[model samples]
Target: MVRSSAPLRRLGAELRRLREATGRTQADVGEAIGRSHTTLVNWERGKNKLSKSDLVCLLAELRVPADVRKGLELLRAEAGTGTSPWAVYGLPDWLRPLISFEEDATSVTTFQPVIIPGLLQTEDYARASHATAPQLAAPDNIERWVAARMRRQQRPRNDPHFRLHAVISEAALHLYVGGVAVMAEQLRQLVKATETDNITIRVLPSSRGDHAGVANNFTVLHFANPSADPPLGYFDGPLGGHMVSDAGDVAAMVTMFDDLRAAALAESESASLLAAILEEYQ
Candidate 1:
């Protein structure tokens, strides 16, 4: 019974407005609620859903009057019975959390060993790539999936706090799912995306032996919400996707990323490597 996030997002916005109206900083609000400033920040930014107790405390501390509190309580109760829109389309249940994370992430870093990360993929490239995916190949479902992926790209434009960094394997650039022309265009898009202030692209050359990400694709999502507990890790599998948020697991993934970064080419070198591959495709 995951609810549509609209209510939660609105709640966050209202909380922020209320705090501002009261001329209270996040720290001040946090102090009143006996939580850390970061946690309060996360709440106001809609990066994390509030627990029942946390919501009650927040409403009390914010001095939300009876009517507003009752309305919020109703929304919360309703949230428990509604399904996430994504579930209707056959996305794996576990992957649902990633949708919310993507919506609120301030920054995302991905290590893709096999394919172009989805957010940067062109529509034709995504369609062709999905055509071979047995589980996702149903024509109707594929269109929905492609639409979802394309929509993910809109985040950077819509969310001023959003930033992305990607490290891609050289093999991904050379694989011509939609032929040389499409691949070439995709590479050009990557180059263009790199020029953006909030995006960075790096290539892990095929010659770079024994990389840490040889095993899988993984992403770390960092929240801008000061109240966010911590960054989270996600990866895909036959069962869809899995999220790892336990402190130790998240730390290990972060450490792995750091090691992989060290093993891969520097940003400039990676860009040069990507350019060379694009030239070959041309």
Candidate 2:
């Protein structure tokens, strides 16, 4: 298992929170753990990982409960490897940030009016879609990109905090990306994925005309921190991508998402829509 930077960062944050809850200064904690305050600061910043012994000592000094200790250990387990297939093939710089956020998100809500969201795409659908992109069409690169997308499924399955909700436009079901056979498989996968407790798929019918999100596709990522200023928003672009972290921008996008979800079909209705589309292919 390759550890991601996100887990380490989250661990650092939890450690800081624990220290604060205990009303102990970094200097005080460091003294108890036999480390310098600067070293403790670096660990809390996620700039470096604390040794196992050091972590044990710090936890003991901070009076961290068993549950918190278990949580930190889980995060440490996730911090082992950083390189994914996407990183290995040098995916675009802008995409790397999205990948990191995707890895860490507690909940992901997406509105995709144009096509199937990447995380839900089947391998064949992903390949065909990527092959059509002018900048990403290189035969070799398309395979790598598709592989990277498939790897994202690992997060939802393995990470307890991860949850995905995608509201797809009806047009995405109508458009045959790879071919009839490929689309059939893709739809089948979508149905299967929806069965997972952590995933939800909803369809926004075309009949809901001229809605708030007709012109854009965006994803909102919520973290575990309720008091965090705002969730992250990601929008795709013709050339690259855009990330919105500013409070105002993210707030507006989130409002739009709420509206989109309201206008979308209920979960059962969405499943029926998918089934109806699949029947057509059959």
TM-score of each: 0.70, 0.71
Question: How accurate locally, in lDDT, is each candidate?
Answer: 0.77, 0.81
RMSD of each: 9.2, 7.6
lDDT of 1 by residue, 73-146 (tens): 77666445444556555654565668876765778888988889988999988888888776746777777777
**Deviation (Å) of 135 in candidate 2:** 4.0
Compute the lDDT of residue 168 as modeled in candidate 1. 88
Candidate 2 CA-lDDT value = 0.81
C-alpha lDDT (0 to 100) for residue 2 of candidate 2: 52
What's the lDDT of the predicted structure labeled candidate 1? 0.77
Model 1: how far residue 266 lies from native, Å: 2.3
Error of 2 at 224 (Å): 1.4
Task: Give the clashing residue pairs of candidate 2, or none.
Answer: 2-81, 3-80, 3-81
